[model samples]
Target: MDPFIEINAIRKGLADGEYSSAEITKFYLDRAKKLNSQLNSFISFCEEQAIEQAKNADNKIAEGSSGPITGIPLAHKDIFCTKGITTTCGSRMLENFVAPYDATVVERLNKAGAVTIGKANMDEFAMGSSNENSYFGNTSNPWDTDRVPGGSSGGSAAAVAAGMIPIATGTDTGGSIRQPAAFCGISGLKPTYGRVSRYGMIAFASSLDQAGVLGRSVADICLLLSQFGGPDVLDSTSHPIPDNWLSSNPKLNPTKPEAKITIGLPREYFDQTPNLKSVEIAMRVFENAGCILKEVSLPSTESAIPAYYIIAGAEASTNLSRYDGVRFGYRCQDPESLSDLYQRSRNEGFGKEVKRRILTGTYALSVGYYDAYYLKAQKIRRLIQQDFLEVFNKVDLILCPTSPGVAFKKGALSENPVEMYKQDIFTIPSSLAGLPAMSIPCGFQNNLPIGMQLIAPHFAERKLIEWGHYFQSLTDWHKKVPELS
Candidate 1:
């Protein structure tokens, strides 16, 4: 019943007949009840259903039919709709909305026998860098309650770090998964865009939105990915299945000599900030792993932030138009007409930050501005993708800080939208390029964790995870815990 055990350890205990799935499920539920007040992580609780699923998993295991993740506890960001679960997406607009079916990711996890604890909070419609934008309330960092847990996947990261659950799911449109993972000192991976199906997961920017895993360790994440990854006919974007990613390949030796492996450092990413302490820690880890660091130019990297804002906003503006109060989302009371209902429902339901992005997106995609703004942004996005592809020709992986710095105090960027967006500078480009990326704790500065990001080319997550695994084995940063328990 120890909440601190990693997923593998728990699985081993279950396989050894030390605990049944029912017992493991109760352990997490009790821990969640104990911690939810302080962490503000889950949006809803699925206790009865989770227990039922866990019981089924126990039966399967007794029948000698269990898989790696069978009976493991799992949580999903609210953005991924689970049938009959109140999937608010952390917005008042959908406060009472329950999905008719589960998201592909949720369905896969269910089939794997992972018990769903509940939906985790997120930025209203996944728009901000900090959890402050969530209508459900900000998720406090377990490391320091006064500081923010980076978002829009902050709740997912916080849940895992706080030990409410060992593994959770998150989506990264830009840096949603990685940034929060960095702030909370957890391991998160944003796979290449099409590596996992997105069907039934609420849309952000379709082209950029990707499903990923947030877990206590690199190994935990790898196991989750093996279960949730691969193609699904329901989602046309899902890529074809590849060889087993869980097994290491002989050709890719993560511990090879520095000259044999190249890790790129984009000068632009560094020059954007004078502080290299976070970057410095990551470099030391790479060196410790025998990686040869090379300074490479991703010249278009400077345009990433601006380009990301335009394209993501435009897509969001179009996608979010469905929540017009006429559909399944929240509706205004006593509306005189349809227009009145749409305006009031949205105005009242959306949090301030979500409203701002909607306005920004509408402006960019508006008739007169479309050609000059949205179209131009798409062009820049193409250039950004090209830059990464070109850089990959010379390097096996790219290393950078997940955030410019560590987690900030809750109110730090509340009134400043630009400053909030800047927190995503190092993360957006990878999402824009549909590249697989991860954030792993490198070290701590001022008692707060710093995350180092690793990005690999399309469908190259195996390599990225391999490199991350090697780095994590040599460093104990991932093992550090907040005194929350």
Candidate 2:
């Protein structure tokens, strides 16, 4: 089996008998074991279970009952609860917790015949912009080990980037999926908030968190979405779709030469970014892609950062309060009483960034300050959504750099929290709006990958995927693998 085979190619190989699912699974398992120490991409590896699942897929293949992803190997971010597997959520609080049932994303993918080989690492409680905040350890960029893989889906992105896995599951709350995809030079999509099921996935911010995919190309995301894109009764947040939802999307015809689409470039991104060299280079790829590029404005974009933090923090505080010492997570030693237990357990369990956000959120949600901070932020969030809604009406999709600049040195932004927050300026507004956004490798700058982001209107992932696939067809940016030694 070719180690760098794309996910779709792997599926084709399985059907054509070129390679068995077991062989492919073993190849990835070996690579994950070999490079995990270097990249710290996986919190736990499930070699035995994955092999069994692969064997099952082979039986299904032999019986001619296999589906699109029936035999593919994938990694799930540790935030999704995997039955009988330790789901740490990259935090010490849940370090010892093993979920009794599978998350909806895990269950749906498993039913689609995909094999999960391991649990990818992430930022602690999905709080940080960098994977350095993980209790396990930071996941390093496969392109350059000294540089950080953007979080909290960094491990998933790193694994896919290194050819250790052809595809992986990720959760996006803010820029977790897209930012890391940009950093690692892979393709990732943060689908609309409720398009995919959230049941069984650990909650961060209920309104902001959404499960998505990261892969070697846009085509992989399309395939995965077809398999798992519908509703789940277990997850009330998942939208109910018509029975023919799969066939309802307009087919993407990338081969047509005269197929020109309108792409909007937000003035806020161009005006606010400190450096735009890499972004400028990436937009050139868009120019020659038969797009009618037009300048647009999302006036509330600057307020997205502050608004996102307030809402995310408030929701996180509420969701995370369940991790009291009485629950099934880490409890502090020698607690004198209930108060001591709650205080010490949280104090001892959480990382610095997680603690900081919790405090900020607690204050924002407090009685006197709730109307001033949380309420106002929600209003600003509505304004941000309105800005996107208005611009999207005029353009088929929006394009911009996934990050303000290329990947920075590890630990550089650790001391400057505000600068670290700004790292998400380009990616957060879409998240706030519950829109579908994608990150594809656009070019390289200073030896690091530059990611171009494509955002579509709510439930318009088909458009984003169509544009992404068409863009990837015209350029080899998505095909450039990091030369990790």
Candidate 3:
């Protein structure tokens, strides 16, 4: 088996009997254990469970029964609950919490035959932009050990980049998927809100919390989407996407005249984010591909940060209230009173960042401030959506830098919380509007990867995927992997 082979090769190799599913599964598991000490990506390794599933997959393949990614090994962000497995969500609150059931995303993928490698580490309750918030410890970037691998989904991206796994699950609420994908130099797709089910995924901000895929390329993402997308009765937010949606979508072959589409370059992004040489090279790649770049302005971009914080914090405040020691989660040693238990458990379980957001959200949703904060932020979110809707009228997609700059040193923004929030300045607007967006490796700066974002209208993931596939087909940016030693 080829060590660097991605999703497509793994599937084909399995079908052709080049190697048994057990062989491939063991290969990844071995590598994950060997490299995890350096990257700290996986909080839990399901080696025995994975090999058992792989054995089942081998039997199925012998009988000629398999799905697209049958026998393919992947990882899930810690936020997704796995049955009988500890769904830590990167916090001590749930460090010992064993879920009774799998998340909807996990269940569907399991039925499709994708083997689980382990539970990837993430920010506590998926709250922080950097994986530094994980109670288990920080996940480092594969490119540079001292630097961050982006956040919330950093463990997923770092693992994939270092060749520990071919694909991983990610949740994007305010740029978690795309930003980390950029930082790790992999491909990540954050589908429009409700495009994928959120049941049992351990909610952060329910309204903005949507699961996505982080992997080698757009083709890999499309294959996963074909399997897991569409309606799930378990989640009311999981809307009905057409069956076999990828094949049904318009072809994005750039060579054809019909494939010609206008791409929008947001002027707001240029002035605010890091205008590095990599950004210039990325723009040139699009221009050289015959894409007509037109200047587009999302005037409301300036307000995305404040609005996203208010709204996300408010929702997070409500969702996290469930962990107050009474039900399951962590319980204090001895509780004299119920209030004491709640106070002690929460303070001990949650990290600094999680506590900060909870406080912010609680205040925003508090009486006399609800309308002034949460309600107003929701209105701002609408304006952000309208900005994209109007821009899409003239352009097929919007493209910009995934992050303001390349991956920063792990402790760079740790001191100043506000500085860390700026990492998602370019990504938050798209999340605010619940649009389909993706990040693909574009260039490198100071030995770190830089990512460019492609965003489409709500549920327009096909177009976003098309452009990502086309770009990756012609460029080797996504193919370049970090040299892990």
Candidate 4:
């Protein structure tokens, strides 16, 4: 079997009995084993457990009880808690940690009989725009080992692109999922806020963090969303399942071909980003797709990175307070006093980046600075969301380059944190607006990949995927695999 085939193709093979679930699992396992040393895509592999699950899937097939995801091979980001498996969130603080329960997404995928190959690496506590913050190691882009895959979900994207897994789950806060998928030349969607339950997933910024799916094509992404999206009674923020994503989305179904899809080109995103060749490629791809392009203005869009940093970092500071060396995570070897233990444990356990954000967040949300910085940033967030809402009223979907350019060489942006934050300028608005958005590979730039982003209104993931599917049908960008082929 060609390991890079999308999820739906594997399903077709399974339906015809051409490949058993176990065989499919082994295919991905062998691929992962071969490439993991070079790519460092996976933080941990559940090889034995994956085979067991595959066997159970085969048993279900034998019993004539099949589900949409039965026998499929998928992976989870290290951030998503998997029962009895390590859920490190790519931070050294929890490097030895294992979750007692599976995250809602993991549980759902397991119940549907999907085999989890392993936990993909990510930015430490989902912090950086690239995968370099990882405590385990940096994830190398499969396309060019010297270049970085996007982060903090870079591992998930690189794994799918390298044919190590059919699909993987990712969490987007800012541009984590979309940007990385763009860099790796895969398809990834950041569903509307509250679209997927957050239960058991490590929190970075509760309001901004969203769990999403990454795959080789739009169809595979849609299939995963249909099964995992919707309200979970366990999560208070979750909403009722939106209408059937695939059937109702006109872009996915061309029954109404006359319906012209409008694509918004945000001038601010292009103007502020460093690269234009990649952006030009994306614009050409959208124009080729028969999309009507219009210049849309979102004046406050430029401030997104600053506002997002304040908000996400502040939330992360609060959310991560529980890891104060007292609980189940890494602790100091010996301590003379309680305060000494608290300081020493965290000082030893946390990586430099996580600690930096913690200090920044804690200070920003501090008593005297709360109203000045944190509260003001929240107001700015409202303005950002309003800008998106107003723009969506003018266009069916907003199109932009997912990142300024293709993957950068490792250590390229390591020293300049501010420069790294700028890479997300095009992607942070949707996260701020709680909208449905996706990154689809449009073409290649200097052998690396460039992703064109599609953004839809809240609960309109169907629309985003529809346009994505239409675009994929026309172009072969998503079909391109890494040299690992």
Candidate 5:
């Protein structure tokens, strides 16, 4: 069995009886278990449950009742609640927490018959740019074990890159999905805000959090996305757009004529970024494809980092208030009073980065500072959104580097929080504007993968898929898998 087998091929094999779903599931499960010690990509394995689901999928296949994703194996980010599985959100606060009900994302995927192999590790409470914030320990990049896999979706990205799974679920509160995808050399999509249901995915920043997918190729990401991307009754914020666009196989029309498509290269992005050799080479792939490339301005790009952190922290402070020791999460031992219990439990259960955000958030939302900080940040967010909207009027899509540079070594920026936040400078503006964006491996820099990001207008995921699929066809970057031993 090819560890990098495409999902469509897997589906065909299952249907033709070439290999049973059980066989594929076991193969990935064995691989994941074997590599986990070195990569620490997964927090828990659903070995028994995954095999059972695979058997059931086999039955469905035999009866000709299987759905599109039936028999496919996937790993869910720990942030998403899986019934009876530990949904840790990469924090000790929920380390022992088992969800009683499946999250909407998990529920929809299960309905499509995708087997859950395990829960991927993530930054604690989905905080931080590098996976180092994860309470379980940093998730190592498959390309370079000593370097960080971008977080909080790092584990999902690493698993796919390491060939432990063909596809996995990820969430992007800021650049969580795209950053890790860039670091680990895989395809990751962060759909427009509210494009996917977030009912059961642990809240990072309510307005910005979105569940997406990570895979070896954009086509594979689309395959898993079609199963779960759509409005859900449980999440009020979920957009009502029909998901029919995702169902179409991108491979059918591999290379759409690109002459009419206008891709904007943000002048601000290119000016600030230092190393552009790999990204420059990638732009030529587009130029050769006959796509028009124009320089556009997004002046608000510089303000994105400040605005994103403020907004995300504020929301996180509010959402995480429920994790008091008095509740179901981690509790301090033998507290004398409620206040002592709350303080000690949170201080102990939460990680250093999570605590920092909570404190910053609390201060921003405090009585005297709300308007001075939080309100101002919201106003800036509107400007950021307007900037993208303005640029969209001139260009069909926006192109930029996913990160300022390739993934850095673990703990490289540990002491410099501000420098670390800049890792997401290129990816945050899109998230703030609630637009669909993705990271595709474009080339390598110093033996590390370099990712180029594509941003489309709101609800324009189909366009992104079309262009990204075509780009993947033009280059072998997305096909370049790390030689994980």
Candidate 6:
């Protein structure tokens, strides 16, 4: 069995009886178990449950009732609740927590017959950029084990890159999905905000958190999205699925787009270091495809980092208040009073980075500082959104580097929090605007992968897929994989 087999090929093989779902499931399960020690990509394995699901999928295939994703193996980020599976969210607070109900993303995928192999490790409470904040330990990049796999979706990206699974579910509160995908050399999508249901997924920053996928290619992501992307009654924020979003054949090759398609290059994003030269070289593919490239301005780009941190921190503080040790999560032993219990439990259970954000958030939302900080940040958020909306009026899509540079060493930015936050400078603006964005491997830098980002207008995911698929067809970047021993 080929570890890098495409999702469509897997589907065809299962339908033709070339192989059984049980066989493929076991193959990936064994591969994951073998590599997890070196990479630390998964927190827990669902071996027995995965095998059982594979058998059930085989039964469905025999009955001719299998769906598109039926029998396909996938891993879920630990932030999502999986019934009977431990959902640690990469924090000690939920280390022993087992969800009683499946997250909407998990439920939808299960109904499509995809088997859950395990829960991928992530930054504690989805807080870090380098995956070092994970309570379970950092996830190593498959390309270079000494380096970091970008976080908070680092495990998902690394696992997919190493071919442990064809695809995995990820959430992007800021650049969580795209950054890791770029660092690990895979395709990742952060859909338009509210495009996918978030119910039962642990909250990071409510308004900014969006569920997406990391995969080997855009086609694979489209196949999975067709199954799970849609409005859900449980999540009020979920958007209605566009009528034409899912076509009959999800893997159909996209036709050449009309010549009038225009992509914007924000001057602010382009004024960076030499590593972005790879992204500039990649722009020619679009030119050769007859698409127009226009230089545009997004002046608010400088303010994005500060604004994003403030907004995300404020929301994280409010959302995390539930884990006070008085309720369901980690509780301190033998507390004399409720206050002591709350203080000790949180101080001991939460990680350094998570505690930092909580403290910053609390201060921002405090009585004397609400308007001085949080309110001002919200006003800046509006400006950032307006900047994207203005640029969209002049172009159909925006192009930029996904990160300032390629993946760095594990401890490189751990001590310098400000420098670490700048790693997301390119990805943050699009996220703040609630637009659909994707990261695809474009070229290699110093033996590491370089990723270019594509941003489309709200709900314009199909456009991104079309352009991204076309780019992959021209370049072998996405096809290149690390030679893991």
The superposed Cα distance between candidate 1 and the true structure at residue 86, in angstroms, equals 1.2
Give the residue spans of candidate 3 off by over 4 A. Answer: 247-258
Candidate 3: worst 10 consecutive residues by lDDT?
A: 249-258
Candidates 1 and 2 compared by TM-score, better number: 2
**How many residue-pair clashes does candidate 1 contain?**
0
Per-prediction TM-score to the true structure, in the order listed: 0.96, 0.97, 0.97, 0.96, 0.98, 0.98
Worst 10 residues of 5 by lDDT: 248-257
RMSD of each: 2.1, 1.8, 1.7, 1.9, 1.1, 1.1
Clashing pairs in 3: none
lDDT of 2 by residue, 1-485 (tens): 56767877897899999999999999999989899989999999998999999999999999999988898999999999999999999999999999999998899889989999999999998877779899999899988899998988999999999999999999999999999999999999999989989999899999999999999998888877777777889988888973244434334556633467788999988886666665666567667766788999999988999998899989988898998978689999999999999999999988888887888899999989999999999999999999999998899889888988777789989987778988999889999999999999888877788898899998887778877887778788888887767
* C-alpha-based local distance difference test score of model 5: 0.91
lDDT of 4 by residue, 130-213 (tens): 899999999999999988998999999999999999999999999999999999999999988998999998998999999999
Whole-model lDDT, model 4: 0.87
Model 1, 411-447: lDDT tens digits are 9888999988989999998888999999998888888
Please tell me which predicted candidate would have the highest lDDT against the true structure: 6
**Per-model lDDT:** 0.87, 0.88, 0.88, 0.87, 0.91, 0.92
Which should have the higher lDDT, number 5 or number 6?
6
In model 1, state the lDDT of residue 49: 93
What tens digits encode model 3's per-residue C-alpha lDDT throughout 210-231? 9999998877887877677777
Any runs in candidate 1 off by more than 4 Å, and if so which?
Answer: 241-243, 246-259
**Model 5, residue 409: what's the lDDT?**
92
Better of 2 and 4 by TM-score: 2
Between 3 and 5, whose lDDT is larger?
A: 5
Query: Residue 404's C-alpha lDDT in candidate 5?
Result: 90
RMSD of 5: 1.1
Q: How do the residues 311-391 of candidate 5 rate in per-residue lDDT, one tens digit apiece?
A: 999999999999997758999999989999999999999999888888889989999999989999999999999999999
